[model samples]
Target: MNVPVVTGETTEKHPLEDYLRFDRLPHIWCPGCGLGTVLGAFLRGLLQSGLTPDKVAVVSGIGCTGRSAGYIKLDSFHTTHGRAIAFATGLKLAKPELKVVVFSGDGDLAAIGGNHLIHAGRRNIDLTVLCVNNFNYGMTGGQFGPTTPVAARSTTSRTGNIENPFNMSALAAASGATYVARWTAAQVHQMERSITEALLKRGFSFVEVISPCPTYYGRMNRLPTGLDQMRYYRSNSVVRHGTNPNEVGVGVDGQIVTGKFIDIERPYLPSSGDGNNGG
Candidate 1:
């Protein structure tokens, strides 16, 4: 089957700047936070996807990254904490033609919203999820979350986090997402491609972006700036995809993996007009 191609008329702009609201300049994210980088990539992806602002819906949960929806000049909805996925599901089902994208933090999706995340994938909802995994919960004073590395210090875990982190791409793939990818903020070009493909995918699509929380996570981990943390990923990350869980456990400090882990076609939820399964 021919995948939905994303193209547009030629224009003399930054490609991404055309779709963004410049007046909304000076976003709320803390200085050195990688969420801005992720947002820039998303805008570029949307442009490459050939999705008009009116036809797309960007939803977000509560967090520093959740504030992303506000900056974008598109149809956006800021929902309750950890409920962005649930809200996006309903939006996609109600308007099957609309492209829905959920931007959230690791804690919002993996901790409080984990159940919803899995269920959405299992049901094969036609939606794209961009999960910015900064490891710690930066919005709430840098507490350890599901994506926080083991032995990492946080406000709650002053000594160190004893729990393991969740590999979001693997989790989504296991849960039945048709498209799953993992990338860091350092890989801006690759992340743009992942987001482009995810929006066009028929079933659940997830892209876990390893963004840097320089303000909190960085201060605790000794990486003072988001740029410094990005440099760490650039130098230490091991780019590969589809590796077994046992092989990539705990992501040793220096090895950050980046690639498209899964890209298999899956069934989307039945529309009311489609026959067979009652809608």
Candidate 2:
């Protein structure tokens, strides 16, 4: 099925519509892609936070997940591969009033972009990151990504993957994110809550979304459809917070841990710096 793309301007009813470049829609993403659900949660979060599109800047890296910024009605910037966070940092520092968001795939964030991710978390910059962890490099074919499970099958790992995956939320929290949370695409309501809080947060905020890669990850794993892919999260997922990552594992079905694991106040970057300029 072809994805539908609607081009239009922002009206009084859907004011944010103007920020989007709808001509790029009917995105190359596969049908029933979890990215769409993540996008919906993002919009709902913005509405709940009362954020006007003009005041928000959505940045994305290369990958199927990066396509998220294009579908949204906002000041969206599709940046170079693995550089969404770095670009967003500059944008936020230049215009303190605007909310900067980084959207990237698991590989874009955890592997190729790992350095940027850690630095952004360390500085506690005011930016919200929505990482869609599909576990493999879906857009470039089902190749093994850093987030791919140890035993998951991929094009590169015809038998099984041996590399360990990163627990993004925990990594962000330890690195210094003021807000950290994890949720699955199926948990839309909770995901919205996480995004809303992240947007309103003062310091670096990280949200790890467990998105299902049906066409790539699912097919390689022998799942029938995207709906079957969801079963992996529903059955194996413990839905427990603060549990030992080692203790929680995806069984034959797979388990997705979801919840607002952490939140804290931190100094905003704008408030810092030498007082000689204007003050």
Candidate 3:
């Protein structure tokens, strides 16, 4: 379970081969999708945190981001839709020694799995949750979702979405997550740093990753490409560490706020097992 240092510059063998399931190379993600970038950042963050892959277990619910669990070479699970958190919670209680991470999409985590997401935070479970917010349900025809901003176009809301999106970081913090952060795919290294911090921290931790679903979200909103989405992030992202999560809800073409909004000590949910701290 030795993880290799990836310089990320080599193209021949690819620096991150050790972390990926090469048999599944050439992922199903569409051209210009940003999942690959987010995945790379997660792997690099895990490596940088000095956590051995064998001790880590990734869980995911059904969605485009759910494919993340299948792509990682480490012990993983592809749970039922909106059930990744519930599964991960049970896994943690059964074997608290293993570090469990729930990697899933905003639609799956926020819209369907939202109850589990908040309860896990309320109890301060020893888990790291990475929610990729692509602004729509990318895997299911690109419809408007819980995080779809007001006036944003989607297959279901072509004219414009009138509902307001949830501030995920705020939800996590309010639900009692000990660590909360938000970053875009364009800020890879920063996202990696935040992932590393979340992994190393005890108790519930949540990181909301704003990614590009150029195939759907971008196409409906006029971005049309991953690079265009990245440019949009560059132009709109404002790093405001410690800002109130409640004030950072993204809007249609609004300022993309990014930061680690909360970090505080809390008692993690206790497990029946011995010799394993809740984190």
Candidate 4:
């Protein structure tokens, strides 16, 4: 007999209870959405980073991925749309000792919050940014987003999107981020390891996670299910460490180039008025 997961209340403790909120038992992501898997990977990576739970803070913007802040047990904030990075920057500036992380989707981070993303990278602030890219705005009726691949189909682009998507890792590296990497949800182990490394990195670190919006992008583009997308990723992804990030743009039919593109030591610019060091 299959038992339904009890949402509101239950005595059974989950293995991740230490880092997640039990009260928010069931998440709102769709059946095939990769948010849960991404969240799980993040939690594991957090543990691997060896940072004290209390010393870490998570910030998320308005979007499906924004709900992550509410699910985490540590200090977290659900901020305005496209403002997760801004909020995280503020948190880090106010409390430099804290390890701040911005967790949000492509639309929230790369679209509305695009300027903040770039400026933060330019400053090289000591922060880790985990961007979950589902290729479209899954929450807002599957509209084409900043990371939506060219020629990909979405509700807004019924005939096929014509706009070129932003190569997230490339943008991060160009903006002076000290660490930049890309991975898909299908590559969970590597993704988790990358997240941990980003957390441990001293300067601005960005990790772009290609996730599945099976309910939206998949249906419009023929992937249809999370399994299909994962299979595609596993089969089509090419792991090339140090590949030119600009050449790693993912497309509807092109191979997904994944790996750490940059990891260079940069001065961590403290937000405090007196520092000449680069962050």
**Candidate 3 runs further than 4 Å off:** 1-13, 271-279
On the 0 to 100 scale, the lDDT of residue 89 in model 4 is: 81
Candidate 3 displacement at residue 186 in angstroms: 0.4
lDDT of 4 by residue, 1-279 (tens): 556489887766666889999788788899989999999999999888777778888999988999999999999999899988888887788877788899999999889999999999999988899999998998888999998888889999998899988999999999999999999999999999999999988889999999988999998898999999988999999999999898898889869999999999988756444211222
Q: What digit string (tens of lDDT, one per residue) describes model 1 on residues 130-181?
A: 9999988887899888988888888988898898788787788889998888
What lDDT score is found at residue 259 in candidate 4? 95
**Residue-level lDDT for 159 in candidate 4:** 89
- The lDDT of model 2 is 0.79
Per-residue lDDT of model 2, residues 1-279, tens digit only: 544455565233443455445677677788867988888788888777767556788999999998888787778899888899999989888877778889888988888888899899889888899999888899898899877888889999999888777777777887888888888778888889889888888888999888888888988887746787777666655566655434443332445677777788877575653211211
| Model 4 weakest lDDT span, ten residues long | 270-279
Worst 10 residues of 3 by lDDT: 270-279
User: Which lDDT value does model 4 have at 255?
Assistant: 91
Worst 10 residues of 2 by lDDT: 270-279
Q: Once model 1 is optimally superposed onto the true structure by TM-score, how far is the C-alpha of residue 270 displaced, in angstroms?
A: 3.9
The lDDT for every candidate, in the order shown, is 0.82, 0.79, 0.90, 0.89
List all candidate RMSDs to the true structure: 6.4, 5.2, 4.0, 4.1
